[model samples]
Target: MNELNPLDRIRELCEQRKWSYYQLSKASGIPYSTLNTMLNKENMPSLPTLQKLCQGFGISIVEFFEPDRNLQGLTKDQALCLSLFTSLSQEEQQLALAYLKGLSRTL
Candidate 1:
């Protein structure tokens, strides 16, 4: 497999969310100037910073690097559902799962 550029990955994630750099800065809790410098200067974020970015994107670090792997064989709607599901809070996720289960029983 070819190597992935971290900066490009960040850009891709931001684009996926329809977020501008300023929005990302707010979500990631990184100063806009710092984020701007890092992206513009091609500087890689440190581990903690990367973690914050993943958190901001509502994903884990593993998902950040291999986003498509798990979703590869899923239908678009399934993938979208999974993406939306991951963004929910823990309690919300449980409720969603319960709702899905109820729906499944009716089928």
Candidate 2:
């Protein structure tokens, strides 16, 4: 798979969260206007800006650079589900698993 530009990564991260550029600005503490102009351009964001973006995505820089979904072979839904599942309590996790199994039986 071709690599995404850093700016592309930022855009992809925002898209995955169903976030508007404004939401990213709020989460990253960057100005919305700045992000809007920067993300639309070819210029790479500065390291500090990148850091803020990573923080907004709740991922490390290393994870940021990891292979994206095309290479990782996870569909968008699976990736989102995994992320949400990991954030749940153990009891909630068990409940979700049971729910999935029950749903599958009805399918």
Measured with C-alpha atoms, the lDDT of residue 62 in candidate 2 is: 77
Error of 2 at 44 (Å): 0.7
lDDT of 1 by residue, 2-102 (tens): 88888999998777566788978887799999999999999999999999888777788889888877898899999999977765654577899999999
Query: For residues 1-107, what per-residue lDDT tens digits would candidate 2 score against the true structure?
Result: 76758988887777656678997888788999899999777768999998997876667787788734333778888877877764454456689999999999999
Candidate with top TM-score is 1
Computed on alpha carbons, the lDDT of every model, listed in order, comes to 0.85, 0.77
* Candidate 1 ranges with C-alpha deviation above 4 Å: 83-107
Taking every candidate in turn, the Cα RMSD to the unseen true structure, in Å, is: 4.0, 6.8
Candidate 1 displacement at residue 63 in angstroms: 0.5
* Positional deviation of residue 74's Cα in model 1 after best superposition, in angstroms: 2.9
> Candidate 1, after superposition: displacement of residue 35 in Å?
0.5
Q: Tell me which residue pairs clash in candidate 2.
A: none
